[model samples]
Target chain A: MKRKLTIFKIGGRVLEDEQALGAFLKAFSAWPELKLLVHGGGKKATQIADQLGFTPRMIEGRRITDEPALEVALMVYGGLYNKKIVALLQGLGVNAVGLSGADAGLILAQKRPAQTIDFGLVGDVVKIDSLRVHWFLETDLTPVFCALTHDGRGQMLNTNADTIATQLAISMSAVFPTELIFCFEKPGVLAQAQDESSVIPQLNAALYERYRQQKVITDGMIPKLDNAFDALRKGVQKVRITHFNQLKKGTHITLE
Target chain B: MKRKLTIFKIGGRVLEDEQALGAFLKAFSAWPELKLLVHGGGKKATQIADQLGFTPRMIEGRRITDEPALEVALMVYGGLYNKKIVALLQGLGVNAVGLSGADAGLILAQKRPAQTIDFGLVGDVVKIDSLRVHWFLETDLTPVFCALTHDGRGQMLNTNADTIATQLAISMSAVFPTELIFCFEKPGVLAQAQDESSVIPQLNAALYERYRQQKVITDGMIPKLDNAFDALRKGVQKVRITHFNQLKKGTHITLE
Candidate 1:
């Protein structure tokens, strides 16, 4: 039997609030099983970008990471936020190591080829080197990852946090039974758009299609759910969409 | 027999130049030995601090790392520069892991208390945890450390690279016979202030004291030489002050 590895991907909402981040980390540090945390870019990046006078360029609602924008991402995601969390976790007695894919070549990416729109310095995950990750995990160190990867040829690329979480889970599933948890502001996939109390307790592809037909899940939640199901298909033992506070009490997605 | 470990401390002059950095890394990569690198902060930190509109405060020619200044240091020193070098080294086929003292709790520091002037967010090294570092080195991963440390109480502090290098060498000397090399722009300790060819080939405590008395080695070089001698006394096998290119050639400092 393979050991269980829980990979938690937390979004900006929990990270931006000090109390919430502390609470979340306190609970995360208390868990005894091997785990990893992937975090998204927070408002601090955009705020710092604005302060630095670099207006962000977007195409089709996707951030176009220009040179200055990439600088902002590096400073915010890899520096301020990543180190802060690592320090906090250390304070809570969890030996945490902060990482970008570039650190130990843990994750290697390919620059997105230009097509209709030029996505400057964006990357798609091409390879996952789990050796260093395994070494870190086996030594009882929790790895906190930032959403940045590198092309093997020496370019740092901004990657999507959700995609990184999914890729890591899929790859590591070969070595360990992986549980992927996507934590965000909402409790779960809400049955009614604005009602937090209407979280769907369980979800799967067939039910997801019916919910799509019913106009229940739309916009940002759509891509999130798609990624969750894809992880389920890729041999990840379980996928949960939940709030940071409700880690165990979220919508559990499975192949029905 | 004790194994030999080389620790190289490189400054911004070499790191800022692409060709110089690449050459240095190429030479470093070809060497098959247990080695580590500690890098100093660059002007990029100041540039970003200016871009963010934070005027750095200085006292006695030392930077006062106020809250905003500390944030900028974390972003530039720990984030942009550290990861960029790690990626470049990876491109050179050297498996390098970038680290801040917060990562893996490698080094714990105490906040600097105010004497005459408050050096806000500055930390003095209190403890050096070499277990994780030893694990990385033993695993064939060259660890590249930045000049940021944590107080182990959720606060990140800006530290001096030379001091960090000294502390690391002193601490790790217990495990291996260590040689600490300080690499910078100058060829070596110059006999004549502006003459590049006036390299002091050998330096010891007596000669260093004579040079001090003659006012030949004053200012910034004094602290560097002090660190070199301190490391020499702390069981580090050797300490050399050299240019990155002259790694095998420059001034060799000794106690005898």
Candidate 2:
């Protein structure tokens, strides 16, 4: 039997609140199994960008990562927020190490080619250095990753946190019985878009597809659910979508 | 015979210029032995602080690490500068891992107590986890450290990069024949601060003290030279103060 590894991908909302983030980290530190954390950029990045006088470029509701935007991401996501999380975890006696995809060549990415839209420095995940990552786990070091990747050619690229989490879960499943959890503000994938109590506890691919067709699951959540189901198909043992506070209770995703 | 390790501490000035930093990292990558890097923050921190509306508080020519200043240090030193160097080194085919003192509990420090003046969040080095650092070296992972240490109680504190390098050299000397190099903009310690060509080939405690008494060596160089001589008094095998480019040619410091 393979060892158990729990990977949590926390959204920007959880990180934005100091009290919430502190409470979440405290609970996370107490977790007994091997664990890893991947965090998304909060509004702090946008706030810092505005302070730096870099107007965020958005095209058709999609964010564009130009030179200045990338700099903001580097400072906020890779540096400020990431290191803070590591320090807090260390304070809780978790022995945490902060990382970007570029560190130890843990994740390699390709610059997203400009087709219809030019997303300046955005990158798509190309590879995960699973061997090195496994070595870190074996040595009992917990890694906290921010949403940044690097092209092998000396350029840093902004990446989506959810996709990074899914990729990591898929890769590590080969060595461990990996469980991927997506923690956000919502309790889980809600049966009714507005009802918090109407969470569909067990979500499989077929049900997710039906909900997508019925327009029950729309907007930002569609892609996240898609990523979670994809991870299940790619050999990840289990997947959960839950609120940070309700870690064990939210939606459990299965392939069947 | 113990294995050889070369440790370099690059000052803020050397990191200020983009082209110079690129060239320096290129040269550092081509180095064919076990190596590590510790870096100081350049003027970027102050610039960011200005943008963020934090008035830097300095007393007696010493900068105070108040809450705002410490925040700036975390964003600049731990995030922006450290990760950039790590990405660039990775691009150059060196397996670089970026670190702060908080990462893996590598460096433990104590918050400087309030005396005549309270330095806010500034920390003095209390210990170096040389065993963990040696594991990184043995694993073929080159560490790139920013000038931030943490108190084990979960507070990240501002630390001096030169002191970090000196302490690391002293600790690692037990397992490796360590050479400590301080890289700055100037070629080496000079006879006259104004003349670039008056580079001192070798320096010892007696000569350094004589130069100090004559007022030839004054101000900032005093503490740095004192630290170098102190490291020599400890177990560090060799110490040199030189420019990033002229790594081989520098004012070598000796105990005699």
Candidate 3:
């Protein structure tokens, strides 16, 4: 078998959309050997964060991982959100394993201080290992990694799902030339949100930053792009940001 | 650090009494240097089984986990029961890590074939390594292990919690000298169910058989004794059986 992996990032919208998500997962194994799944649970995280009396914030459209926000992220990313995805795959006859990034030490880092930067308990990925993911794959299982990680100490700090996916994708690509696909509610990388067909066929670093600065792609997309850049820098060949429907198609690199 | 481990056998009764369970977990970590929890969800399992049109049976008072029974077992053991315990601990300032026997290969087993003598997917603990549990304990983290194992294929199968606790206690004993404590609703091993004060202080092989012959210490207790015996035989020196309220006060054994 060729050393190739496909990392599919499913957002909260797709999961909350029960009917579509079920149909999509049911037909997963049929859609080119789906090697790994790096999922994001946006809705659950927000709700849990609110319940915990922590306000979620975004800096440059990326989630600012404040201390409280980190708890919310872990509960959603590791608890509620993680289990739901595992159950879905279970329904679809898949040996879906759910793991917090802390389980196999998937992501490690030096802690960002509680200073002006304000990314409380947040960590930047300094090490990434796909060995645990590989073990699952060898057992004919698909790993659904939750974006919950620890800082080598016992504390659970939150990391962004997009960042988690990028780190994971980069690690996966080191062993297998992989495609990291992120699925959102939108049809694809849209030049115009209202027009579903206005797919931005590809993007380079310069063009991505230009669009971000021009306010063409506001909130959330920026961090995603940053994550995409990180993945590319780490030797990942392909990364796609598109809607759930466009998952089976569209490569994120070609500027069509 | 000496090889001192703690094995907590959490009964289904604890979930029914949520507040008490939570309090107990909070108090449990008072000496959290080494710990692993084995939990049961008989009530939840039975309720789900009944709703799903399954009639649970028992061989010598142990749930005869047929396929249908096993489905409910999964729902209770892995889903509702496991998560609740984890949440309770987390709520009470304990960094309790909940996992099934499948995670980190905590437990390994062989499937009992489907026959008239049905054990369902109920597995015999063929192997268990304390590597992961030890890591958790060393880091002052409490690991709550549910009695769920994967078939090394895609299916998650439910095994008996007592068996899980016994094997785990034995495996970890080499390093942690883990104490195996099984907590139930009833107060201690009763010599007479009607009399709360009839709690047995101690027992030996002969004494256990004598009680069985008299049919006085019957139902559920048999398997527990068998498990205790097996654990002791496998190098685990002590086993405690008690009610939740009398958790700290109960029978302790130093087996031959």
Candidate 4:
């Protein structure tokens, strides 16, 4: 039987970590089934922002990517962060190719103009043209996507990595049953923040809403889970959210 | 009679001037030929370098792009600059698509190891994969390439726009009898820098090297000529170097 394919969301931390990145890439390169990479650049973006004297702001847990921050974010996401991840994987002998949503006109966005509120440089993924991406895939290269996109007319915009992944998955679901496995700094969705014993095995729509009501899903973890469900609802059947430490050791998500 | 195919080299200055960009694109975008766009970002890159407190140094006429400067270069080339060019051309009703060399594994490179004549985030154009590029060309979408490239792993490196244009010309030489045109802020290559009337219409190998000897052809200009010669050497019959102001009629270069 063919191994099921998975899309792994490796954050900037893991991609930049020499040891971790090398190991992750080695495993990925070893896998026979198709795997897609969607990535974020929290670390590199922060570094460049600090150097440029731009203090980044966030709204609703999303980086408040205004103009200056957007400029720096472009440096981080598509340039610094994207290449670093691609290089590390290439070092591990993976045929890894890095990209931003703009390359090959891969992804397009309608400017997310400041709405009732503002998202600044952030964009809603309006369109996905996966042709060039398929070109890389056909050439036996695993695409490591940087979480950046283009406004339909030629502006680069900051977008959430999870959103990039989910959008890609939604489009991909038309061809194959795609799965997204989001690997992060923390273990699987915690029942209790500090207690390893209170592990939640599964989550369903009702339970997710209840958790949302209880405010347990207040931090960065909420968006990741929400993105997972969004992908599931859009047609992807499998999404595994687990800590990087538990990767390749047979980790699973508890969905109700 | 069919209009001769002209390779238009659009400079950053014209791209920065909104009205000029729109007008030029309105005219140039109408051409149906094998058009290659090569551009530079002096103003934006220099501005960001000034803001970041780094001495923007140009070695052998090429910007010495360490990590910080490389970040800035990317903002100008891949982010704001690339999109702006593509968007304006598209707005002019040209089926235009923008690309940074980093995308589609088109431009691959080798990162210089640390402390040993470090090229920073600079890359050599290894291969121009025509698969995706050809698709866009056939579909009537003009490709606007940003002067950025990748190592095919994950690093985005800054390259000269002129060099990219030369290589693309050479690559297309076999298929289309390519011509490389470099558009700059100046009227054209001059025997006298101040005299627009002194534009050199053509150059043979011996004469081209004389310009290189006097250092009048130093800096970015050298690569432009070298690439022109490279294209000719690799089977391209001609390369044109001119100013955007002259693009309506186009310029001519004859190498014998």
DockQ values of all predictions: 0.81, 0.80, 0.10, 0.32
How do the residues A73-141 of candidate 1 rate in per-residue lDDT, one tens digit apiece?
988998888988999998998889999999889999998999998899999999998766877898888
Chain B only, TM-score of each candidate: 0.97, 0.98, 0.88, 0.86
* All candidates: interface RMSD: 0.8, 0.9, 8.0, 4.0
Docking class of 3: incorrect
**True-vs-predicted CA distance for residue B135, candidate 2, Å:** 1.0
lDDT tens per residue, model 4, A210-239? 888997656777787788788887888687
Using DockQ as the yardstick, the better of models 1 and 3 is 1
For model 2, the superposed segments whose C-alpha errors exceed 4 Å read none
Report each candidate's C-alpha RMSD, comma-separated, in the order given.
Answer: 1.5, 1.1, 7.9, 4.2
Give the Cα error of residue B218 in candidate 1, in Å. 1.3
Worst 10 residues of 4 chain A by lDDT: A247-256
Which whole-number lDDT from 0 to 100 does residue A93 have in model 3? 61
For candidate 4, please provide the TM-score of chain A on its own: 0.88
TM-scores, each model vs. reference:
0.97, 0.98, 0.63, 0.82
The TM-score leader among the candidates is: 2
lDDT of 1 at A59: 96
lDDT of 1: 0.90
Residues A101-200 of candidate 3: C-alpha lDDT, one tens digit per residue: 5554555655677665566677667776566567557656677776666665545656667788888888888678877888778766677757778878
Chain A TM-score of each model, in the order shown?
0.98, 0.98, 0.85, 0.88
DockQ of 2: 0.80
DockQ of candidate 3 against the true complex: 0.10
